[model samples]
Target: MRAVIQRTFETALFVDGEEISRIPSGLTVFLAVCRGDTEVQADYFARKVARLRVFRDENDKMNRSILDAGGEILLVSQFSLAGTLGKGSGNRPDFGHAELPERARELYERVRDKLREEGLTVKTGVFGAHMYIEQKQDGPLSFIFEC
Candidate 1:
């Protein structure tokens, strides 16, 4: 499982020109599930994201987790994150490492639910849908985690 986590001042998800989910002062997660990924990885990643200390503290230092900062999360499924480029003529991006849709959806939900269980407000984009995401990234801060 892979997650691209971005700290944001605000974020929203749009599908077919209509807003579906939104958050304020939080993190936006673009998650990808690789072949053979399991719920155990999902659970671990969810916990790690919640405890990641990317938020600034009273001392203006990056010392607060999303939980400590009282932030929300906007989770979006992004299979393309697993895309790979090969050598020579096969250099085009390939998604062979991505999990099938059914399994990927299941794992995505597990991560979303787990984060909610951790007492953080969580919003989500529609799984498998084409979406337009709008976000004002805080400090242009971002991180990538793989599990």
Candidate 2:
């Protein structure tokens, strides 16, 4: 599994030109399930995302996890993250490494639910829908995780 995470003051998810979910202040996570990814990878990913200390603390140091910072999570599935670029590929994305949609959606939901079980509010985009995301990034901070 792979994820691109961003700290945001506000974030919203839109599909078919309709807003479906939003968060006040939290992390916007774009997640992808790669070929061979299993529940083990899902478990590791959820734990890491819950514990990642990207939020600033009292002294203005980046020492607080989202759990400590008190925020929600906007989880969006983005299979394209698993796409590969290389020679003889005609400059097109090769999704050969991305998990099939069925299993990928399962793992994506697992990650989302696990994060919620860790005590953070979690909102999600429609699984397979093309989504439009609007986010006011805090510190423009972003991080990537893979497992």
Candidate 3:
């Protein structure tokens, strides 16, 4: 499993130019599942995402977590993250490492439901659709995680 986590002051997803989901002082997660990844990886990733110290605290230090700040979240599936880097080595990008869409969706749903149960406001982009994200980044902070 892999995810690109961006800390934003605010963010929103649009579908057909209509906002479908939005968040404040939270994270926008672009998630990708690998062919061999299990639900346990999804569970671990979600917990780490919630506790990641990407937000600045009262001391102006990168110490506060999303959970600490009562932040919201928006998750979007992106299989491209699993693209093998062969194209740079004179071959086309190989996406065979990516999990099938059907399984990815199931794992994503598991992550979403688990996070939601923790009392965070969680939103999501439509699966398998082109998504537009408007992000107001308070700190212009971003990170990547893989497991």
Candidate 4:
């Protein structure tokens, strides 16, 4: 499992030109499930993302986790995150490393539920839909984590 976390002043998800979910000030996470990934990895990434201290503290230092900063999370399923360029061939991307759609959706829900269980406000985009995401990034802070 992998997650691309971005600190955002605001983030929203839209599908078919209609807004679905949005967060005021928090993190927007693009989550991916790799082939052979399991629920254990899902849980681990959820906990890690929630506890990552990327927000600023009193002295303007990056010292607060999303939990500590009282922020929400907008989780979006992104299978393309697992895409890889050709190893020794033409410049073509391969998505062979991504988990199948059904299985990936299960893991994605696991991560979303885990974050909710941790008491963080969690919003999610449609699992397999064409989504349009809008975000006002905060400090352009971003991190990628794999488990």
Q: Which candidate comes out best when scored by lDDT?
A: 1
Q: lDDT of each prediction vs. the true structure? A: 0.94, 0.93, 0.87, 0.92
Task: TM-score each candidate.
Answer: 0.97, 0.97, 0.92, 0.97
lDDT-superior candidate, 2 or 3? 2
lDDT of 2 by residue, 1-147 (tens): 888999999999999999999999989999999999999889889989999999999999999999999999999999899988888788799989999999999999999889989998999999999999899999999998888
The residue pairs found clashing in candidate 3 are none
Q: Score candidate 4 by lDDT.
A: 0.92
Which residue pairs in candidate 2 collide? none
Worst 10 residues of 3 by lDDT: 84-93
The model with the greatest TM-score is 2
What would the per-residue lDDT of candidate 4 be over residues 46-90, giving only the tens digit for each residue?
A: 888889989999999999999999989999999889988867636
The per-candidate count of clashes, in order, stands at 0, 0, 0, 0
The parts of candidate 2 lying over 4 Å away from their true place are: none
Model 4 clash pairs are none
RMSD of model 4 against the true structure: 0.9
Q: Let me know the TM-score candidate 4 reaches against the reference structure.
A: 0.97
Steric clash pairs (candidate 1): none
